[model samples]
Target: MFGYVIKRHQLWSGKVLLFPLSSSCASGASGVRFVFGRASAAGTERRTAPAESTGQGEAMYRRKMRGMYISKRALRKHFDPHNYPRETYLLCELQWRGSHKFWQHWLRNDDSKDCHAEKYFLEEIFEPRSYNICDMTWYLSWSPCGECCDIIQDFLEEQPNVNINIRVARLYYTDRASNRKGLRELASSPGVTLEIMDAEDYNYCWETFIQPGVYYRFSPENFESAIKRNCSQLDDILQGLHL
Candidate 1:
């Protein structure tokens, strides 16, 4: 039979001492020969080497802990792992239309069609922390103006820290229906705190020329000035209402 035992005073290599017990213990024997294996000091040193190395490793680990900044909460959380991952972002693309629809699509998935539309068309109103608020629409008349205020409120909530910028065509004129919708949207959205600027209008005869009747030419400078004037009037109304 073979058995192993370790003493507290023994070093690392001293843990595996084997003792062999012969089956002749029951016999009434007067003398017994016991062979004792002598271990050299070098062998003893080698046996204890691993323990010494481990102790050194532990010392280094403790030293490293001095530079570590481990919050108690963090330590507890790490030791007891959580199943949930931290949320990192928000996605916004609601209430958009026309070519702006393409930007909505891009926000959802970048490989969408019409990705290269003009920068003036796609304005990104972001928070101070670089979070997206929402896409602003130039063709405001499509939606009723009454709903504009709520939409603007929602936008502000999404990006509370950043300012807003309204993008409009420099010389763009809308039909009666589009204009009505635009006015409604702007009127509804009152809490919209941001800068509004008209985009430099591109003169295309086919679109702007047919305004008066069969053809109507547009003046970019005049359109830009007109929008600014309207916005100023709206601002006054907002102040009057104490909004």
Candidate 2:
């Protein structure tokens, strides 16, 4: 049997005694041997160590919370082009046969501190996926830039099993001849279909792929109006580019 004895009075009296009883000792035996020590007043007073707060740890926790909040907010505004009017946002929906569930990724121009969204997705999301037959549809607020166009071309060349369809709200064409040529080449790439999303396609993507539960007031009419406005803006830009 193992037991411990604590004497609070002895501790208060500036003396504490401890003794280990032998197995042969009876339950109610007296004359228990003990080691005694005199306690100082300072020693009797309890002191608790204060908790150490780390600035780096707190900063990291705050950053994590901020990232989660931003991601949640991004999900709600994924289909709304007004959130990042000047920048591009790409939302990819991946669906496989025999599965009702789908994997979705939202990539914004400034999502990463170092790399663009195309590189970020290629390195983080695409590299980790196992070989499977899946259809990937990309919904872009604006057509991919020249650099991203190249990346997509290379990715498609490597992953033949995965088919890609790109639907854009606005055409990405600049006065730069190289950019105009790259966009044309990308549109004509094999195993990839690139098209400007019509009103029906826009509504279908917003209602079916985006966070539909959060937007309770979302309607097809609103989506159609937004698509028409975006199309007009795209037309003006395209006309300016003369292509």
Give lDDT per model, in order: 0.25, 0.47
lDDT of 2 at 102: 44
Q: Which numbered prediction scores highest in lDDT against the true structure?
A: 2
Q: By summed lDDT, which 10 consecutive residues of candidate 1 come out lowest?
A: 56-65
lDDT of 1 at 103: 17
Per-candidate TM-score against the hidden true structure: 0.25, 0.54
The pairs that clash in candidate 2 are: none
lDDT value for candidate 2?
A: 0.47
lDDT of 2 at 7: 14
Q: lDDT of candidate 1 vs native?
A: 0.25
Residue 168 lDDT in candidate 2: 77
